[model samples]
Target chain A: MRRAVSALLALLIFAYLFGVLLKAPIPGDYRDERYNYYSPLSGREANESVPDHYVERGEEETGSQNIVTSIVVLYRGFDTLGEVTVLFTAATGVAFLLSTQRSKGEKEKKKEPNFMASTGVGLVLPFILLVGAYIFVHGHLTPGGGFPGGAVIATGFVLMLVAYPRFQLREKKVSVVEAFSGLAFAVIGLISLIMGLTFLENYLPKGVAGTLLSAGIIPLIYIAIGFKVGSELSAIVSHMKGGEE
Target chain B: MMANLPFIMVALFIAIGLYAVLFKTNLIKIVMGISIIESAVNLFLIAGGYVKGGIAPIYTSAPEGEEMVLPTPQALTLTAIVIGLATTALLLSFVVLIYRHYGSIDSRKIRGLRE
Candidate 1:
């Protein structure tokens, strides 16, 4: 009976969604003119085209060839910082919740992974790390950024953990890296604030947009985010794995 | 109407996820439901940012006069995806703890909170 009720409810929800989808404007067909100008202050329709304005002058203003990076790290930086905090909180909560269980030393014996799996992971680990580093380092000139790059790096750690069951990540080292990177992110913001700009304002030189070392504070911020995210995610993975004894 | 196929798919995803959350008795299935809902929301956001014949927002290679897809939504989606990862991890850890305590992941059977 419960299953029947659930199915009925799902069908009803699906129908409602279908109706809304049918009536909703098609994607890419609607273009709001308000997105074509730059308006820092309120009360101007002609000057409020945000996406268009950013596209036209983003590289010049932020020295980041990648407009998305400009948006993520510069214009909306506070939100990113908050997002990072959310990730950190989640990682900490997971560790705290699982730490009640006995440590790995007292856990049951783990089975040895297959030789083939171990060998493959060993071979691919370095490449994964390198690719992740490349993604964040070139964030200002490419599609990838701190979040995806950090995820890739954490995947490498997971691979190692899976292939070598006895292998352990140094918790203290990971924590240190996580803490320092997070601190650096905030410190860079503070530096900008001290320079008489708003928090996280770009005070450094806006170098050549397409160059590797360009986008002054952007690359620095992204690199910091990459390290912070990578370590926190790796810690989360290790904690969850430890719980699976 | 046909161009809205992706939106329809998004709706279906949310519905399926909602069904799983409401109807499933298994804790793990509920987690899966939540994940499906996350993906659906992400897809909706990405689709909302699409532009007809729009290129990517990168400055190096985009042709002159070509409209670029809105970058804000993509950035927001990236943040959401990362948050989703964190939330999923935390949820799974809770599931593990629950299973350890109750010896099973059946939602109906574990009524300690209610009692």
Candidate 2:
């Protein structure tokens, strides 16, 4: 009976979606200038939208090679801050809840990881960490940024945890890294204010666009975010494995 | 033909995910459904910014004359993806807590806190 209700609800949702899809045809490729944004800030008809402006003059204005990085790190920075906060909240909740609900006093005997799995992780772990570091460090000049890089780092740790359940990643140390990275992100944002610019505004010199060291505050912010996200995710994973209170 | 595939995939993904979420009795299956829904949304956002032959919005030795996909949706999707990650973590944690307390994960069995 409940399954019937669920199926009915799902069918209704599908019908509604089908109706919406029929009304609004999805374009495969948007190459038409007519599709260019109608600028609202300028109150002009079909004037350059924020994205068009960013595309045309992104390098000149932001000195960042990756346009997405410019938008994510500089223009919409405060929103990213909020995102970090949300992730932090989830990590904390996981840690707190799991710590409280310890799996009784006696720790279960852990099975040893197979030789192949442990050996494979040992060989691949360094490469994963290296690639993750490269991603965040080269965020401004590359496709990936903090989030993907951080995820990759966390993936390596996750692999370790899976291959060796007894392998302990000190929760205290992980939390320290998380706290420091979060603090570093805020500090980078505040430095812009200290320079008399708006919050998270680029204060440092934007060197040559496409260079590894360019994009000023953008790289710094991504680096902080990468570290914070990496540590937070690892801690959450550890907690899920029944970490101690 | 291929251009519209993304949206079609989006519809199918959402439909399946919705069904899983609405019909699944197991908490873990429900969480997986939620994740599927999130992926569908991400795909929708990305598809919203499709260009015929546009490249990524990066300038590092980019092709001399090529279109760049809209940066806005990608930016928004990035945030949405991370937020989804956080929410999923919380949801899974709740599932863990629920199992710990109730000794079961079937939603139908979990009626009240009166134990």
Which DockQ-derived CAPRI band holds candidate 2? medium
lDDT of 2 by residue, B50-109 (tens): 676789999888899998888888999999999999999999999998887888899988
lDDT of 1 at A61: 89
lDDT of 2 by residue, A1-245 (tens): 87888778877877777667655545533446356455677576553767777888778888999999899999899999999999999999998887886657547678889799999999999999999999999999999999999999999999998899688779999999999999999999998899899999998899877788888889999999999999999898888887743
Alpha-carbon lDDT of model 1: 0.89
TM-score of chain B of 2: 0.95
The pairs that clash in candidate 1 are A35-A49, A36-A49, A37-A49
Compare the candidates by DockQ and give the number of the best one.
Answer: 1
Number of the top-ranking candidate, with lDDT as the measure: 1
**Fnat value of model 1:** 0.86
